[model samples]
Target chain A: MAEIIAASHGLVVTQAKDISQSSLALEADVVVIGSGAGGAVAAYELAKAGKSVIVLEAGPYVPSSEFTEDFSQAIVQLYEDKGTQTNADGDLMVLQGRCVGGSTVVNGCVAFRTPDYILDDWQKQYGLTNLTVDALEPYFARVEANLGIHVNPEHEINRNSAVLREGAKKLGISWKPFQRNIRECALTGHCLSGCATDRKQSMLVTYLPWATAHGARIYADTKVTQILAENGKATGVLAEVTDPKTGVKKADVSVKAKLVVLAAGAVQTPLLLQKSKLANSSGQVGKNFACHPSTFVVGQYEEDIHPWRGAMLGIYVDEWAHPSKGGYILEGGGAGAVELSAVTQPGLGEDFMDYMANLKKLAGIVTLIHDHNVGEISWDDDKKKIDYRVAEADYPAMKAAIASAVKLHFASGAKKVYLPTVVHAVVENPAEADAKVAAIELGLQSLRMVSYHPQGTCRMGSDAATSVCTPYGETHDVKNLFITDASLFPTSIIVNPQVTVYTLASYIADYIVQN
Target chain B: MTQNKNKAASDVSAALAPLSRRSVLKTGLWAVAGVSALAAGGFALLRPSPRDSLPVPAGLVHLEAQHYHLFSRLTEILLPTDGTALLPAAQVPVVNHIDGLLDALDPAIRQQLLTGLALFDNAAVVTHFKRFVDLPDADALAYVGDWVNSGVMPKRALGFVVTKLTHTGYWMDSQTWPMVEFDGPVSRRWGIPSRGNQPLPG
Candidate 1:
C-alpha cells in the first residue's frame, strides 16, 4: 500500500504521523505528472534504474473490469469533456481519452512504427539529426516487445472491414493487414468503446502495473495545477485533488521534487506550462497544433455482412499516403452500432431504411487524413477553457481526402456512397458518386472534416525561439523541466501516434537516466 | 325462496357446464386494462411540461417532428415484416422511448422539427398524398420511406439528421444492445479471453 498524503490549508499535511513522516515525505528524484504511455515509460525506466519516481495521474485507476463494452458510459467516464464538441468551423467532434492510460486506453490497438518517409522528412525539414528509421529501430523493437505487438492475420475479419479489403482488392489499391497488440482477440468490434475482453494491451495494464511493482508511486485523481519553479531552476509541482463528481476546484498542494516531467498530453501540457508562467521564453508553447481529420463512407452491399463481428480496423490502404492528384490516406475506421447509428444522417432516413431493409448487406469504412495545417490552442483565462482553431489552408487537404475516399468506395464496388459534402452529398449509387468524381476532376471545395488525433501543441526542437522544448524534451530555458507526451511531437506523422508516443517516451526516459 | 332456488340452479349448471374461453379472455382483458390505466395515470403525474423540459428551441421543433417521421420510416425499413407476427417498427415499444426523449427536449427544438416534417409533407407533396397528417400511419410511413429510399428529398437534411438521430437514439435507449453479435459469457465478466470454440451444456 502507498502512503496517503492529504492537503490542508493549501499545504502538504501528513494524515498519519506515526509512519516516519520525514522519510516518506522526502522529495523524489523524479516526479512525473501523468501515467500515460509517455509518463509510464519514463517512470518504469527511471525506477528500474534505482531512482525514486512518483507519478501523478489526473484520472482514476480503472481496472480491467471497469473496461466497459458500453461506449456511452466509457466516453462519459474516460473521455475529456465527456466527448464534447469542438467548434472547429462548425461543431467538429473530437474524442480524447482522459484516464490514467490516456488516449491509449481508448485507441484502436493498431501498431505501426513511424514511417521511414516521415522520419526522413523530419531529418530534412526540421534539422532533426539521428532520427532515421535505422536509428529508431531498437527503440521501436523495445516498445513492441513490452506491449506484445503482433499481427493477428488468422483472426476472423468482420464483414464491414472485409468489405473494405475486398473493395481495395477490386480497385488494385496497395493494402496490408495491420499489426495489433492483441494475442487472442475475438473482435467483437468495440475497440473504440473500451476493450472489455482485455485483448487490448493499453499502457494502463502493461506499463503502469510494472512501474508500480518497481516502487513507482502513483497518485490517481490528483491534477497537477502548476510546475513550481524558482531562480530559473526546477523545484517541484503544486496540484489539486479534485472531486470527480462535482468538479469543485481547490487550493494546490506543493510537492517538492528534484526533477519534473510533464506528460499531460498535447492540450493540457501547454495549458499547464502557460498557467504556471513557465512559458515566458518560448511563446510557441501552445502553437502548431495538428490533428488528422477523418470522414466516413458507408457502402450498401448485396450480402448479409455483419459489420460488428470483426476487428475494428483490420486493413490499411497506403496508396493515398503520398501526394497524388489528391494527398491523403483513406483507411478503414470502425465503431459500434450506437455510434454508427448516431453518425448516420436523418435526411438519409430513406437511404438508411432502404439499406436497413437489407440490413445484412451494409458495410461502412472511414477515411482518415494526415493533415498539414498549423492550428493553435489558446486559453481563456476567465473561462478556463481551451480554444482551438485550425488554419483555413488545411481545409483543402481534408476536402481532397473526402473526395479520394468516395472515389475508392466506388472503385472497390460499393453500390452507393455518401460524402459529407453539402453540394454533391449522399450519392444514391456508386455510379452517381463516380459520375460526380469524374465531373470534378479538379476537386471540390467547401468540405467539412472531423479530427481524431490532436497533436503537436508544445513542440520540441533545438532552438528555443521556434520550439518549446529540446530534443531531450526539456524546456530550453528550464534545466530540470521536461515534457514527455504528444505535445513534444514536432510534426504529425502519417500514422497512429500511440506507438510513437510510447517509443519516444522510452527514448526520453533513457535520456533522463543517462543525464 | 325463488331467488335462492334460481341461484342454486345456476350454480349447479355452472359447475356442470365447461368454462367458456370468452369468460376467461374477458377477465384477462379487464386485468390488463386496470394495469395499463394505473401506469398511464402514474406517467401523467410524473411527466414534466414542455417548457419545464430540457430547453429545446422553437427552431428545432420542426426538425424534431421531422426526426420522428424519419425515425418511423427508417425503423420500418430496417425491420420490415416477414410472414411471422413480429411487431411493426412503428408499434415497437422503442418508439415510445424515442417519443419520451423528444418530450424532454426544449419546445423550440420540437418546433424546428416541423421544418423537417414540411419537407416531406409540404403543400405540393400533400396534394399527391392527400394531407400527410390525415393519412393512415402506415401510408404516411410508406410515403416517407419511398422518398428517402428514392433520394428525392434534399441531401442537406439527410446529412443533418440521419447520423445524429442514429447515435442519439441508440445512446438514449438503455435496452438497445450494440449491433455487434458475439458468443461469450452470459454474465458480465470483464478481461476474460474469448471462449470461441468451447460450448457449455444447455
Candidate 2:
C-alpha cells in the first residue's frame, strides 16, 4: 500500500501522490464518502465497533503544521470552488470548506444543541417522532464530552465580543457566551483560515484521528462520481483519484462495501444522488433547501478595538431568536482585512481607503436568520446550480436585525454604524436608524448574503412519498444506503450545525450497529 | 420655361438610364465597401484594445497578457498609491496575486472573469470617450462608481467582482498588515507547538 506518513496504531492514510497505479480496488464492510463532521463521527463509531471502514475524501489532507493563517492561500487550498461558489443569482457567496475536515476546519467553532422547539416542529409537522430532544440527548452529551465543547470563560471573551455584551446590556437584550468545540483557544483569531494551533477541536484533530486510530483507512483526493447499487441495495462507489492542484485524473478507485454512507454535505449529497440517478423516486432529493443566511453590520468606534486579536467568535444575542419574535440571532466577532474588505462599501478609491484605515477601530455584529426552506439545487448541464432566494416574508426580520444592530452600536458610543446593504446605508444616531433600515430594499444584489450552514436539500421525514430519506436517514427507495449530513436535516436548525451533525451521525451509527 | 425644364429632366433621365456597365460595377463595389467599413467600426467599438505594451510577467500560469494588463490598471484605480495607503498599490504585485488565484479557480470561472474584465474595460468607450486603461484616473474612478451604483444587477455584480479581488489581493500581503496593526499569523510569534492529532488540553 502506498501510504504517506507511516501507518501507526491501526490507521492507514493514503494521499493522491502515493497511488501510482491506474486502478485501485478495495473491499470494506462500510464505506463513508466524506470525512467531515458527520462522516468522521460515523467512521469512528463503526471502526470502534470492529467494522472494516474506508473513508474517501474529495479534498487534500492538510495537517495543522501546514496551516498558514493566510486567507488568500487558505481560500484556494481549503474552500470549495476556491471560495467563488455563489448562488445562481451571483449575489450570495456560498462558503463551505472542501478540505478533509470539510467546513469544520474553517468554521468559527460555535456549537449548539438542536433546540427543543425545532425538534418539536419536526415531530409535529414532519412526523419525525424519533428525532425528539430526549432521544438525541445521549448522542449530544457523548459528542460534547469527547470534543470538549464548552462555553468560553470570561478570559476568552475579547474586546470585540465585549462590544456586543456592552451593547446588549445598554439595550436590555439577552446575550450570553455560546459553547465552542475548542480546548485552549490560543486567541489567534484565525478560525476562518483553519486554526494552526490545533486548539479548535475540528474533525481533523478530533473524530477523524480517532477513527484512524481505530483502523479506518482514509483516501484523500478521491472524488466519488457514482454510487453503485444492485437489486435496490447499495453495493459500493466509483471514484477518481485526482491531483489536487490541476485536477488531472491520476487513477480510478473502486470500493465494494456492504453499506454505503453519503455524507458529502447538503449541496454535493443531493447532486451525487441526481448524477447517479438513484434514490429519487420521491422527487424530493434536492428540494426544501434551507440555509441560515447571514450578514454582518460594522460599527465604527472612537477608540481602537483591535477586533482581530482574540477568538474569532464569542458572545451571541438571542433576545429575538424565537419564531414569534422574528427568529434571528446576532453574534459578536471580528474579521481580518480580507473579510472586512469583501463587505465594506462606499464605492472605491479614497472613500474605501479611508474606511480601511479604520480597520483597527471597527467592531462587527453578525445576524443570522432562520430562513425558510425555499431553495432548490439542480444540475444545469455539467454545472451545479443553487437557486435560493430569501422569501419576501423574511424581509421584516432582516430589517429588524439591521435596526437592532444600529441601535446597539449607537448605544455603545459608536460614531457611525454601517448597514449591511448594497447601497451602503449609514446611521450616525439612533433616531435615524429606523428610517434608514426601513428604506433598505431587498433586491437580488441588495445585501452581502452568505451561508455557511446549508441544510435540508435531501430532507428526512416519515412519509415515503414526501421526503427523500426515512427518519433513520435511509433512502426510502434504496436499502442499506444511508445519509448522515446536513442534507438529512428536515429543517434549518438556525445555529451553527456542526454539533447537531455530530449528534445525528452518532445516533445513526448506533442504529447501524444495532441493525 | 416649365416645358423646357421638363424636357431637360427627361433628357437627363434618358442619359442616366443608358449608363455604361463600368459605372454600375463601381457603384456596387462602393456600396459593399461602405457596409464592410461599418461592420469593422462596430466590432472595434465592442472589442477592448489588445495587449500592446506590457511584457508578460514571469511565471503567470492562467491569465493572458491582456487580462493581466486590465487587472493591473484596475487594481491601481481601486487601490491607489496615495498617501493614505501604507504601501503603494503598484508595489504590492496585486495582479500576480490575482493570476495565482485564477490558476486555482475552475476553468469556467476563470473564463467568466476574463470575459467580465474585457466587457468592463471596453464599456468605458461609451461614457468616457476612452478605453478604461486610457482614461484619466478621475474618469476611471467615476466610471467604476457609475457601474457600482447602476440599477442594473449585472453591472453592479461586475463591479463587486473586480473590487473584491482588488481588496483581497491588496490586504492579503503581509506588508499591508501593519496598516491595520494586524500581527500576522501568531503561531510562530507565540511559539505555539503543533499538537499533531494529540489529545485535547485538559
Candidate 3:
C-alpha cells in the first residue's frame, strides 16, 4: 500500500491554492489530456517506452481506496454534474465521469470487445480500410488478456441478473453473461460509485498505477483548456487546475510536448479542440455524435429482488441488438438509493414513498438502443455543451426495446412492473403495456432517454472530409495531435465502451511507439 | 476538468444530524456553486444572455423565505410525512432535508429548481386570481398535480425535478433507511472508509 501510494502520488501535479497567480510551464515528450482508459494506457505505454508523458485529468485523484458506498458523495465526486449532464435540448441525460479513472471508475465494468460487425462497418462505411476485424484481433486480444476480461461465472450471477437470464429464457431470447474486467469482485453492487474493492480492474488500479510506476506524470484537477498549436503542428497545451468539487479554476499551467494525445472523451475532446481552434479542417470536430441512449423499466415482485445486492449489471439480452435499423440491448441494472430516487418515475407524495419503500422488491433492466441521429458538441458559455436530439426514425426501435423490457420484467415474476417510459405507471396486466407505451410519444419530454456511453463527434476516418482524426486517431489537420478515446470511433460501438476504448488506446500507443 | 473528488466524496450518508464532514462539504460545494453561478451571471452580463429564454433568476444563491417555505411545504406533500416501520418517516424534518439537498445540488439543477418553482404558474399568472402560496392546501395539491401531469414543458419539467428531489430527500432521511433496508452508514456498508481526508470547514 505504501509503495503504491508513493509511486502514484509522486507523479501527479495537483493545483495548489495560489498556482493560478502565474503560469507553470513544463515539457514532456507526450502530453495526454484526460486520464481515463485512453490516456492511462497511452501514458503507461509511452512511459514504459521511456518517453516523458504528462497526463492531464480534469477531475480529482480518487483511488479505489476512496470508493465508498455513499451514493450521493460518489455522484458528487465521480460524476460530471452529478450524473445529470443533458443534451442541448436538456432531454436525454449523459453519465460521464470526471475523476482520475474517468467513466471507467463509475461504469459497470462491462468489457465488451469491439464487435467484429462494428469494425467492418467502420472499415466499409467510414473509410477505415485498415481497421479490419482480423487486423485488430491482436489489439483486442492484448486488452482482454491484460484486463482479465471474462464472463462472470454462474455462481456470481445475483438475483437481479438471474431474473434477466430467466426472463430471456422464458421468452426464448438469446442472452449471455456480460464479459467484465474484474478479479474477485465482492459484488457489493457499487460499481457506479468507483469500485472500492480494487477488483473491478478500473484504470485507477491498473494501467494508471503502472503508468505512474513507469515514470508518467499525472496532473489531477487540471483542465487543459487549449491544445496549443503553431505552424499547424502540435506544440503543447495551456491548462488550469480547476477545483473538481466546486468547479473553480485554481491554477494556470502549460505543457510543451513533441506529440499530444487528446483522449478527453467525446464531448470534451471536441470542445477542447474547438477552443484551441485546431483540427477542424474537416468541420467535424464536434459533429456526427452517436451513442446508445437507454431507457429503463423496473419491476416489483412479491419476493425480494435485492436489486442493490449483486453485480450492478451481469446478464445481457442482445437478441434485439442488430447492426442497423436501430435495436436495443437489455441488461440487468442496479442503483443505490440516490440514483434510484432521482431517475425513477416521478410520482405524487404518497405514491413516490410507496415505490421507494418497496425498493428491495424491484428489479430494473435498461434498454440501450443504437441511435442513428447525429448530434453536435459545442462550447456554450465556456462549458462543454452537448446538443443531442433523438431522431424520429430511431423511436420505433427505442419503443420496441422498452416494450421488451416491460415484457421481460413481467415474465420474470414481477407482481407490478413500473415502466419509466410510461411515466412510471404500474404495469399489472400484460394487456396494459402496449396501450400505455403507445400512448407516450418518443421524444425528450416523454421518453426521457439517457446514455452512459457516448461515441463519435471527434471521429476517425481515412478521409478528412467527415472526420476530425485519421484512421489511427491522428487529427487530420494537426500533425502529432491525436484523439484516442471513444471520440476516435467514427460510429457508436453500441455496447459498454470501456474495453473498446482500452483496446483502441493500446493500438494508438503501439502506433505512437512504432512511429 | 480535475475536480476535488475528495471534497465531493466527503459525505457518504445523507443524515443531517451531527454536522458531519458530508454536511461541511455540502456547504463548501454550495458556496463554490454560489460563486460560480454569480460568475456565470456576470459572464452572462458581459456577453449576451446565453439563456435569455430561460425563466430563471439571474444569480439566485439561497432561496427566498417565501420560496423556501413553498418548496418545503410542497416537499412535505410530495414526500411521506408519516414515518414507516423501522423508519421514522414522520420524525424527519423533510423540508429541512430538501433545503440541504438543494444546497448540494449542481448549479444547473438548482437553477432549474428555482426557475421551475418560480415560473411554474406562468399560466396562472395570466388568468388565475391566486398565486401558488395564496392557494389553500387542496388547491396547492391540485396545482402540483397539474404541474406533474401537464404536457407543457416548464410545468412538467419542474414537476419532474421536484419529484426526483423530493424522492431523494425522503430516501436520504436517515429514518427512511430501514424501509429501503439499507444500512445508512456508507463506510461500513462498502468496507473502505478512505474518504477520511474530508476537508476542515472552509
Candidate 4:
C-alpha cells in the first residue's frame, strides 16, 4: 500500500514505500492533516464541491471487520497514548482515538449541535459576524442528514440509560433520549472499543467513505510532522509514513497543496503550527483551552441494571446544562470490569472487591461541568504540557452535579450511591452529599477530572490580537491555512461537540469554495 | 521487528499526549467510556510457560515467564477472585493476551512497574520473611497493608503501584467477564438473561 495506487475512482493515492529512503511527495488542491470528524467532513464536502483533496491520517486503519470485542485489544489498537493518557497534573485519565477516523471512530455516536448561546457568544464576543446560530442552522441540518443522526427507539435505550431516565424522572430533572449518528445499531454496547459491526456512522462509515468516492485520497499510517509554509502561506506538509507492523519510520512523505486545512484536532493542529513557527504572531495559537471536567457517580441498584446490555448511552439529564444557572449535566455511562475495578472507589482492597462482586447491580453516571476558564497547552521540554486550570467555580459545580446524581439514584431506588474519587467513600443519603463533596480537596490526587471535547486552543475571532484564526477557521497569520477542528471554537459548549465539529467543517468547506 | 513493539507503543503513545490537558476533556462526561480489563469467566489458568530461559522482553513491560513468577504470585494475592461473581475463573486467563499488552506499553511506565516489583521482592529478606511470592495469601495481604501504611516514600509507592497494576490486570482479562456477569460481544451472549439482581435480598 505504498508509492501510490491509481484507484478505479480516477484518483491517484500515492504514498511512500520508504519515508527515509528518499523524499516522497504528492500534490493536491486541498491537503487535510486529519481524518476525524472535521477533516473527513471538510474533505468530503470539498471533494463533492469538485475540489481535489488529500487526507493524511496519523494512525493505521483497523477495518471494522478486524475490530475486536476484547476492549483491551481495542484500547491499544484504536486509542491514543496507550490508553494511559493522563492530565497535565497526572490526576485524570484522558481517552481519545488515534486511528484513521480519529476519535469519531471510537466515540459513543452522540451528536449535539453547538448550543445557541455559545454561537451567540462567539458572534458577540469573538466578532464572528457570519457564525450566528441562524447562519449555522442550515449547515447543522446538512450535517445531520449526512451523518444519519436520529433518536434511538425505546428498545434501543438499554438498561443503563433506562436507569438514568428513571432516576431523572424521580428527581424531576429534565432528561431526554440522546440523538446518535448510528445506522441500525445492534446494541453491541462496546462503542468505546470501536464499532465492530460497522453500524456506527462515524467518519469511517460516513464522510471519509463519501470523500473517498469523490476522489479524496486517504493515507493512514502517515503522521504530519510539520506544516510546510513559505512566506506566511501554507504550501504543503512534511510527514513521516511508518510501517504499521514494525512501528518503523519508513519514509518522509510530503504533500504540496494549494490550500492546507488542519483538522488534526485541537491538540495536534496547534502543535503542528507551533512546530512550524507559523500562525503564532498573535501568540494565541495554543491558548484558551477549555474542557468540561467530568465527575463520576455510581449507584448499586436493588435490581439488576445489566448496564452493559444497551446502546452504550441513550439518555442525558440537562437540568444543569444552562450556562447561566446550571453548570453541568448528568448522564449514564458503562465501564467494563477493568474500569469498574479501578474506579469503584473506597480504596480499601476488600471494599472495592465487594462492589465488584455485585457488578451487575451497579450503574454509573457522570457529571460534565461546563467549566469557565481559558487554560493553556504548550510544548515544554519536547513533551506536550497541558495547563488545564480547574477553576474554583468548577468545584461547586462538580459538587452540585455529583450530589444531584447521588440523590437521583437514591430516589430511583438505589441502595448505595458513591462518588468515586481519590478520597473514596460512599454517600448514604442526600443530606450528606454536599458536605462530603465540599470537604474533598480539589487536586489531581484528591479527585479525577477528564474531558472529552477539548476546545479553544486555536480560537477563531475577528481580531488578530486575541485569536489564532479568522471566523472562517482560516489562520489569521498563515494564508491558505485553515483549522477546522474544535480548536476554532471560541469557547466551550454544554454538549457533545461532534455535531459542532461537523457543522463547522462543512461551513469551512463552503467558505473555501465561495472564496 | 524485535524493537518494533516498543517503538510502536511509544509512537502511538505520542498521540496520547497530543491533546492539551483541557481540549480533549470536553468530549462530555457521558459521551465516552473508560478503559479497564477484568478476569474472564472460568479461571482456566494459562500459567506462564515453564521455559527455563524465556526471551527477556526488550524492557520490563510484563515480566517474562522465567522472571515473573514472583510478580505472578503476588498478583494472585492482590487480585483474588473469590466472592466476586457467579462465573468461575476462566479456563484460560481473563486477560489472556497480557503478554502482548505488557509488551505494548511505554517503557517509562514499565520501568516504574518493575521498580515497584523489585521493591516488593526485596522487602521480604529485610523483613526476615519468606519472599512475597512464597508467603501465604493471608500473610501477603497483611504485609501489603503494612507496606502501604507504615513504609517510607518509595516503599509506600510500590505497594500502591503494584496493587493497582495487578488489580487492573486481573479485571482487564477477558476471562473476568463472566464473574462480573458481562456477557461480552453480541455474538457471544446478547440474548442471554442477566443474573437476577440476587432477588434483592429481602
Q: What is the CAPRI rating of model 4's predicted complex? A: incorrect
Q: Candidate 1 at residue A462, lDDT? A: 72
Better of 1 and 3 by lDDT: 3
Instruction: Put down candidate 4 lDDT per residue, B1-202, tens digits, no spaces.
Output: 2222222221122222222233223231001111101222222122223333444334444664433665465556655556655333333332222444455555665544444454455455444334565567777777777654432323343444455545554555555677668766663344422211111001
- Residue B62 error for model 1, in Å? 20
For candidate 1, the per-residue lDDT at A91 reads 27
lDDT (10s digit) by residue, model 3, range A1-515:
32323242222445444355656788999999998888888888788788999988888777666665566667766877655466755556677898887988788888887778888888898898887778788988877777768888986688888987888899998899989987777777887777665667777767776777667878888888888888988999998877665667767889999999998888888888898888998898889888788867888888888787777787999888875634678888876565566554646667766777787887888888777748888877756667787878777877788888888988888877776641456677788988866767666456556688888888888888877888888898999998889988887777888888887888888898999
Q: Which stretches of candidate 1 lie over 4 Å from their true place?
A: A1-26, A88-90, A249-252, A323-327, A346-349, A356-359, A382-392, A421-424, A434-449, B1-167, B170-191, B194-202
Cα lDDT tens digits for candidate 3, B133-198? 445666766677776666654345555555554555556555666667865334455454232111
Q: Write the per-residue lDDT of candidate 4 for residues A1-515, one digit (tens) a residue.
A: 23322222112233444244655778999999999988988998898788899999888777766676656667678877656665575445556688888899888888888878788888899999898888999999988877678987898788877877887887787998888988777777888777776667778766776777678898888889998888888899999888777787888888999999999887777888888899998999888887777766788888888877778888888887887767688878866665566553554456666777788898878778887756787787677766776777677777788778888788777887877554456877767767776676664345545677777789999999889999898999989999989899888886888999999999999999999
TM-score ranking of the models: 2, 3, 4, 1
- Per-residue lDDT of A326-349 in model 1, one digit per residue for the tens? 446665665544444434332433
Q: Please give the TM-score that candidate 3 achieves against the real structure.
A: 0.86
lDDT of 1 at A13: 14
TM-score of each: 0.73, 0.90, 0.86, 0.84
Could you give the fnat of all candidates in order? 0.06, 0.34, 0.21, 0.19
| Candidate 3 interface RMSD after superposing interface residues | 10.6
Can you tell me which runs of candidate 3 are displaced by over 4 Å? A1-21, A243-250, A324-326, A422-424, B1-61, B81-90, B103-112, B121-138, B184-202
Clash statistics: count for each candidate: 41, 0, 13, 41
Sort order, lDDT high to low: 2, 3, 4, 1
Model 2, span A429-453: residue lDDT tens: 7788888888888877788777899
